[model samples]
Target: MSSIKSPRQIAESLTELWSPRVVAEVDDAYIKVAKVQGSLAWHSHEGEDELFFILKGRLRIEMDDGAVELGEGEMFVVPKGVRHNPVAESECQLMLIERKTTQHTGNVVTEKTRSLSDQLRPV
Candidate 1:
């Protein structure tokens, strides 16, 4: 059966900052949503590209080469092997599209890093 999922409602329902919950899956990728603020640790996916879609507020993706700022309804894709850090001065909501094998924090693990099991939970 098919169901409807609202990214806005799911994103707004999130209680933990930086913790993304798996909302849906599209073949090899998982579509996720999270409410975030502040800066997440720098990390890079070795073999997968990650996509970020800003749902609310603004986001600044700090890259080694340059930084990209995204406002509401904007989206960006961070290519594989590119080191990047996501930052939001204020609370922000976003949708993330990543391969099932893509690690949440990539090679670097911090206190904020969330596991696949953790992400595959109900919001």
Candidate 2:
């Protein structure tokens, strides 16, 4: 049987910035946690929507349409095909819900990008 998981605890245990670790799964989506600072590339998933829930610090998601700021306990969802960049002025911990096939950086690959195999690593 599967055990219960603590998203915040798992997120806090991560040592790598911008690298996400899978925490759980629900149907077609994977629940993940990440420790981030600075910025992730501007990109969009052609077929998957990405949801972000703040667990610790602040984050600003910049998009062509506008930008949204999220604080601890807040959340946001970036629709599929919408280009967005997630930035954090200081270290922030967050939970992410995304389709299993969602690309880490969408269509843009950079040094910070992590493949599905990498994200699937044990937390």
Candidate 3:
């Protein structure tokens, strides 16, 4: 059986970096934490929507239709198959939630799309 993990524990295990670290999983979805700076690649998940919550600093999401800016405590959802890019001029802490099988960078497959394999804990 999987053991329960608290948010504090997950935070402690995560290292501050531009890439995301899988922190928790619940059924089909996984929670990923990341410290982002600069721009993320443009891409879209073919089969799942993605949710991003800004824990600290600011984030800007650019899409083909428009752009949305999120501040600390703000959240947004990118619908499945919609092309989007995330940017942070300064360091930003964020929580990403999506299907467990979802790729971090969709089909882009760039070096920046590295995954935090097996890091997710059940809580």
Candidate 4:
């Protein structure tokens, strides 16, 4: 049976910033939701690209090349091995799609990092 999930509801239920909750899965990729604010550490995923879909507010993905701004209902894909950081001037809701093995913080682990196990818990 397929379970119906609401990314917005899950994102809103999140009590921790930058902590993503797994809401669904498609093959080897996991669909996750997160409530974000401020900035996340600069990092890169060497083996998998990350997909970010904006659900609410605005998001700016900063890279050495430049920064890409995304508004509600927009999406962006950060290629593998690219150094990037996600930033939101205000609280933003986001949905992410990435390989199951993708690290929460890529190569840079911070105090805000949450493990995959933690992300799998119920929202």
Name the best candidate (by lDDT): 1
Task: Flag regions of model 2 displaced more than 4 Å.
Answer: none
Q: Is candidate 2 or candidate 3 better by TM-score?
A: 2
Encode model 2's per-residue lDDT on 1-123: one tens digit a residue.
999888999999999999999999999999999999999999999999999999999999999999999999999999999999999999999999999999999999999999999999887
The clash tally of candidate 3 reads 0
Tell me the whole-model lDDT of each prediction, alpha carbons only.
Answer: 0.97, 0.96, 0.80, 0.95
Point out the worst 10-residue segment of candidate 1 by lDDT. Answer: 1-10
Rank the models by lDDT, top first.
1, 2, 4, 3
Per-residue C-alpha lDDT of model 3 across residues 1-123, encoded as one tens digit per residue: 876755434544466555677776778897888778899899999999999998888999999999999998899999999999999998788888999878888979775777645344332
| For model 4, the run of ten residues with the poorest summed lDDT | 3-12
How far residue 9's Cα lies from its native spot in candidate 3, in Å, is: 8.1
Compared with the true structure, what per-residue lDDT tens digits does model 1 show for residues 21-122? 999999999999999999999999999999999999999999999999999999999999999999999999999999999999999999999999999987
Models 1 onward score TM values of: 0.99, 0.98, 0.84, 0.97
For model 1, the local distance difference test gives 0.97
